[model samples]
Target: MADVKSKASVLLVGGGSVGAIAALNLETGKQAAVTIVCRSNFNAVSQNGYNIKSCDHGKINNWKPTKVLNAIPKASEGSTFDYIVCVTKNVPDVPPSLSDLIRPAVVPGKTVIVLIQNGLNIEKPLIAAYPQNIVLSGVSLIGANEPSPGHIDQDFPDTLFIGAFANPNLSPQTQKAAAEDFVSRYSAGGKTQCSLDTRVDWTRWRKLVYNSCLNSICAITDLDTGRIRLADDAVAHLVRPAMLEIVAAAKAAGHELPATVVDDMIEMDPLDMYLPPSMLSDTRKGNFIEYENILGEPLREGEKLGVPMPTLRVLYYLCQAIQWKNKELRGLVSIPPKGNYVT
Candidate 1:
């Protein structure tokens, strides 16, 4: 084992499914001392620890990290974190942005901000917030979730692709080193897959092909990926066309995706598998969905480049309406009384 004193101090800011499983692997690496900031799960995790059944790490019971905190400020107190891994959802339209939430713990040049969330253009806000800091763009392809507080289940193996977001303020060497360092620590245990990609935007756009098309479809229709494919003419008429639009947009944005990527993504899951996507899960729970990053941003980008995305445009508005309805249902938004007819 590496010397305890030499372990990098990591403050993980999300304790959801992805966050919880990530904490497990980070702790397992032995290269970082992970302190997970649990918001909703704080009580359960702090009191009972986590019970995880994983295909990657095997079944581990009552697993707790080196440290756990209820809030981000508490983790920041008297501690200078070397890395702040943000595994939270990137709901840009929501209040208390991720940059704002994690600002207190950021040590500027020292603390590397690693974002493991979804959607497009996620790095821009962080880059603007901490211009001097090295921001690593991470794309996680793992299937993990906490069904309940302190209870985790991961059927898919972890495959993480990490790369540094270009910052004019910091040298490429500095950014590259930070990305490499974090990838090394994350993969030190040899139980997970992490790779450094110089063209991470390519990967992001690649993921967009799936998230923008299928994830959105799943959310709006309340169908798992498999059922969506099983639906009458859904793949040929809706799913494939939407994915193709994303590919066209990605190409316009200068990241040419493989021609076969759309089909590969479609065939990734069996037709009968009842796997509800993250967006669908959020919709079921009456939580906000990430329409802005996943759809709005990409749609706007496509529009800017004169790439017509009718299917994606329709999906974006539908998802936005879902978000509005969810907010209204939760009483977070109150609609005004119907206006007097002026006609």
Candidate 2:
């Protein structure tokens, strides 16, 4: 096994909330070199730096980067990175949009691609594309979002679990070393805990179960997590049935998740909790939600495996309808007036 270094040159795709937090955390490691690429073309981030506002860490402003590019430029041509972290949404069709952005920064055999997105379906396509590159699956527990163009808001502090997907050639020693290096960088940098996992299947499914319950409900209702957590029996009546369908789906997928994870999906009162889900935030910002990736795909998988998921199937279709309605409303609101209203 090769000795992993304390620092690594990283190319981070997706400068959304999670990406920003990763960038801030990377700053604590003196040896680490980091660059951020986003669709927003945040050239100002490279100039004035990032301002991260967090409830746990107060205000962190002017967190500069080694480099920041609005888009991955040709100037970065032929440059290979030690690590490539994909923090974008897990829409299977969207990988092509990122292929051009990622191709230049990747160096076969040495670069490790860490996917820190929602859903279990990302592994297959990423592995198929970069067969020679190391592919690792990761789940982020933190909640973050951008309120404006350059500002990041951290809703909660959470841990990161990372492990290999299907690379049998990845030695246990090498995996542990790589995981340790990541944990050290984040822990030393004052970010949340980073842990190595041999069995990430449970971790990934646990998160999926959580999202399957929370994300679509929040999006359809236009409510934050607090509201859902504090919802009364009427809401529970609606939610629990759907959750059970997800459990059935998971079973069909060959993952035996504990029933307790679903039974206790919302354990706290919303009045006491202050967190909002990414899906709800996405709806608010008029951005595309990973609806298909998170809800639709699992439902399809369940059907393929002959699992009954009536509630999930219904919820998925309902969420899609709601999204379409929301989009139509936004379009109507954005239209310019041919003449001023006389009212």
Candidate 3:
């Protein structure tokens, strides 16, 4: 494997909050030749650059990358990338389709794609699109949001865990080395830590359990993390049952995720942490909620695996209905007679 530091090209799809933060961090560390592709027009980002404000790091203004493309356009005809980082939401009903943009960058044995979104089911579509490309899954505990175009606000700086998909033929040493290099590069000027865990699937499932319990519920109730943390009754009454369903779904999917993961999740007090979830921010801004990828996917998979996930099913449907209702009230879109939970 080539040294990550020696690499000259990197493509970052989805210039949302997380993507912008990652790009700024990567640029600060001088990691590879970085290019950020955004759905918004180039003139907008080019004029103002990116403003990244973090609780840990003071506001950064005009943090620009090597290149910013409005969209992924055939990879510049012959351009290739060493690493492709995808930080887009996987809500199927959302605009700016991420999978279609990323498909052009997945060349096997040449490009490695790292998914840093808040979902558990991005792998299926990614693999179907580029089976031979080295696909890695990861979970970020960091809290981030976009206050405006070309601006990202990171509330909580947290750890990142990354590893290749389960495969007997994967080279562990190569994966570890790559992960370490990525961490070192991104964390050079920051305090974040990235670890290489072979148990990538378990880690992802653990995060899924967390998201399943927190994101949508907070969005639906319009509660902040601090409120949820202080409310133990809410955890036991609502969160725990949903977590149980998520655990059952993970187990049925052949991943043995421990129940203690949920306990650890609830142990995070939002007041002490002083961070809000992206779902809450999305709801406040009237953006689409990523209900399907986090909650709906698990519920669907659970049914297929013969696992009972009633709590998750109900929560998923409720979130969809709520989002649909919001859209209808706002006159954003006409709600379909049969509500679809794709987003």
Candidate 1 residue spans exceeding 4 A from truth: 1-5, 74-76, 337-343
* Per-residue accuracy of model 3 over 1-343 as CA lDDT, tens digit each: 2234553477888787777777776766565667888875356577888877887557888877888887664654876887888887677765546567676655665577788877777777766666555667768877777767877778777567777764334476665666666666666645566677777777877888878777777887788767876666877778888888888889988888865778877666456764557777778877778888888877888899999887787789988987787668767687558767787
Question: Candidate 2 at residue 22, lDDT?
Answer: 79
Ranking by TM-score: 1, 2, 3
Better candidate by TM-score, 1 or 3 = 1
Find the candidate with the highest TM-score and give its number: 1
Residue 264 alpha-carbon offset, candidate 2, angstroms = 3.9
Q: Who is ahead in lDDT, 2 or 3? A: 3
Give the Cα error of residue 19 in candidate 3, in Å: 1.3
Error of 2 at 116 (Å): 0.8
List per-prediction Cα lDDT, in the order shown: 0.88, 0.70, 0.73
Best candidate, lDDT: 1
Models sorted by lDDT, best on top: 1, 3, 2
- Give the per-residue Cα lDDT of candidate 1 at 294: 90
TM-score of 3: 0.83
lDDT of 1 by residue, 38-139 (tens): 988899999989989999998888888999898786335687788999998889877889989998888776789999989888889998999999999999
